[model samples]
Target: MIPDLSHDRIDRLRDAFRAAGYDADGVVELLGPEAHVALGRGEPVPALRATTDAGPLGTLVRLFLLGQAEPQAAVEAALAPLPLTDAQAAGIVVADGDRLRAGLDVRPHGVGDDSWWVVSDLDSDLRGGRPVEPDHVLGVGHASLSLVRATSRRPVGSVLDLGTGCGVQALHASTHAQRITATDVSKRALALAEATFRLNEIDVELTEGEWFDPVRGRRFDMVVCNPPFVVGPPRTDFTYRDSGLAGDDASALVVRQLPAFLNEGGTGQLLASWVHREGEDWEDRVSRWLPPGAGVDAWFVQRDVADPALYVGTWLRDAGYDLRSPQGVQKAGEWLDWFEDNGVVGIGFGFVTLRRTDAARGEVVCEDLRHAFDDPLGPESDQWLRRVDWLRANASAEGLLAARLVTADSTVLEQVSEPGDEGWSPLVHRLHRTDGPGWQHEVDELGVRLLAGCRGALPLGELLELLAMGFGEDAEELTRAAVPVVRELVRHGMLVPAEWAGGAQ
Candidate 1:
């Protein structure tokens, strides 16, 4: 636990920031990523490597990212363009000490709805989890967001959050559900979650249990379980990392039994793991878990595929132990042996979402796509709001794509091509076309050209025509190409409908 924040100190820090020529917002961004560096390393992080424009403040920001403690000497050496006041420096020093000791980084921005995060033993090493030390920023990897949204598909009468480490999903679900029953096995984890709710004054039913045992038969309208999905053999110290289950199959088992614990018409939102074996399809492995005739929209996205050695070695290091340790080496070999015995070629990680449609019917849809971590889906708890709205309004993919997308500030267009392809493959811009939908876009060269011009009101057809002239492609052909691209963007939230206030799925 960390010390309580003193308003006087915060005020002092605020004044210091102002004195150093930073407005409230600027200081927040400066502090967000740098704070992590400040904790991770003892020295101040340096400024931008490729650019010279960041100035002294930027240098200080880098110093902070390196986990530097009061780079006072570095500051003096660099002779910052805008110097910091002593009070500002002192307050930062105090704050830095507080954060470093706790192994936490409180981002200065976007902290709504269970925003506080501790770099997990797994996250710090594996390079996963919340981005920018805050809540889920909107329009991150939308597939994971899709998995997250699927959890909210239920009526949300009452929700249960299992393994609520930082309480990210729990806090978001709180607004939709009448009440939340959150459970975790770790006392440290529970306490951290308790502190978060207490600070925010959000109420949730808290309990200490190994999986469902604590809340057994205590049914909920929706059950959200983001368990330790890393598939490995048990460790001596049970943590947020290892579930102590035997293999990847454990997560599937949790999904299998989860329905029994949910209210009729309730949905079970599961971020799960399964074995990608030699003779078995990973999707088939999950299908065996769904109850007969259960209405399940199972989207199992194998975002990553790792073999036995790579898979076991990755997790073995997560427990603060390395394969170099003789015992560690032996334990790692056990995991390797287990995968080999099962004829598993690789492991699959993704979601198993089940919605109870009707007592007599069940369905499962397994989708495999490559996606990344969502670093910015914050405060948008009701994703279905825009999704359902777009569905109602557009009525078709073509219509949806025809809708205009408004990209926001600090957004970028990320183009990923299929491996071994010659053609300039489809490009998806990671832009905030609108709230509720912030994924990727079908950006033909013209769309990119149009995107460069999409700062204001411009007809989609006209944009395509402009691109057609530039690329020497037929304007109608370009428009046709962009239509499907636009629809896909809208469907995947790369281009959200206008007026979407951005809710979680």
Candidate 2:
């Protein structure tokens, strides 16, 4: 079950900690049970002085949890070359060109297995989310892997993960494709990913560059990116969230180049944000992001949109900036200027699924998918793969037509019970219904049983036969029932008849 959460409590606690004086580099020592007890009992923590200051330190913690980039260890590593201030437990370490270190060490510092974290000290800098440090946020965790599967149909030859922050998508892509490449701007972020790869024992090629600079002319079977899509100016101390680009053009530039970098039969899946201007529709603005005549099949999912002012303030708070503060006011002003100058009133955030035409085949699909994505309706890709393998073994339509079939438990045998009858009536021809209570024949214990045995292989028919031989049933009737499921699977392209190489099919 998902955790019951209260962003409200988080907000109050964040403010309290900053009022208590904390730095943003993952320090949360001030937020022990004592702090919670005060809030729980409506008692105030005496340690935190009442102040009008917006807590930049506490806000940094919030941004990290939201998966923004941060140099978790750079300030510490540069310690000898820079001056240090007491922050959290050990102290705050910072590096400006003139200097290199200022931070809060919430506890006694220690290192584990070549990894660095301020241990023994409290973690006030972590915001409220301690375990979910931003440097290691990307992974095959629940949402990241779900993203990998939903992005496209698989068995791809190669895939590329651009702005591959935590290397989460790239790691998962290894299971679906032969080769994978991941690129990012920060070496610290890349280092965390490298550690992740070492821990998981998954091999992936890693490179460093801004956007597509390092990957000049490379093409891939797929491209995946979770770009910096926040459409606002950075807090005085900027890290991963702000890429210093105006409006949504940062995301736009990366997507525009996809056609040139996509191999034949490749798809680019991007989790991005775009800006919407007052005079034009948001959809048209994004539709224009695609290069002219590139003919890429694009599916954009708009989950959230916020007006410029609100968007700016939200990010400011995220980075622990107080809009009323002098620096905060200036930063917010700059964002408003950029937004208005670009004719952008609101910012649109969504995912972009692009399937580039197989240029080698001279095919092109230039259009938009206004239809909803992420809602699973059709047969899954694995089910489709099974159908393909079945066809490879039995090429002719006659072979499949004459085959005996058996049913499985997951194979529901739907039949109307007559008023006086006990068991359900078996169904024959395929029936169509929107809710899909299609006719199901009698299920064989063996057919339903064999699914566990076949792993993920074999289409419905081949598995049915194993059941037929295991338990005697009329082969033809079972085959008849199986045929419709197969065809339906084929119609949905979950299964294809033995055929084309390339995109010909």
Q: Pick the candidate with the highest lDDT.
A: 1
lDDT of 2 by residue, 1-505 (tens): 1111123322333343334344322233434556434533534332132211224443333222221223434322222222223221222333334432223222211112222222111122333323222332332223344455456546888888887766667665666788888888876556545544543446788898888887888898888877766665433234345566766777788778877888864777776687776678777778788877775655565656778888888766665565788878987888788777778877777666666663322222122223344543112323323444454455565676543332222333233344437655533323222221122233334433542443334545566666667678676676666565554433333223333212222
lDDT of 1: 0.54
- lDDT tens digits by residue: candidate 1, 1-505: 3333334433443343344433324534555566534533533223233112344454334433333343454444333322334324322323344221112332222223323222121133222222122221111122334455545433467888877775666766766788888887776567556644553457888898788888886787788887777776554334655666767656867777787777765666767778786778777877787755555434344556777788777665544455787877887778787777767788877655555544243435465645554433222323433343455466564564455555444346666655445756554534434332234444445666766765435555666677788778897777767676665444455444445424222
Return the number of clashes found in candidate 1: 39
> TM-scores for all candidates?
0.55, 0.48
- Per-model C-alpha RMSD: 12.2, 13.9
Candidate 2 lands at a TM-score of: 0.48
Task: State the TM-score for model 1.
Answer: 0.55
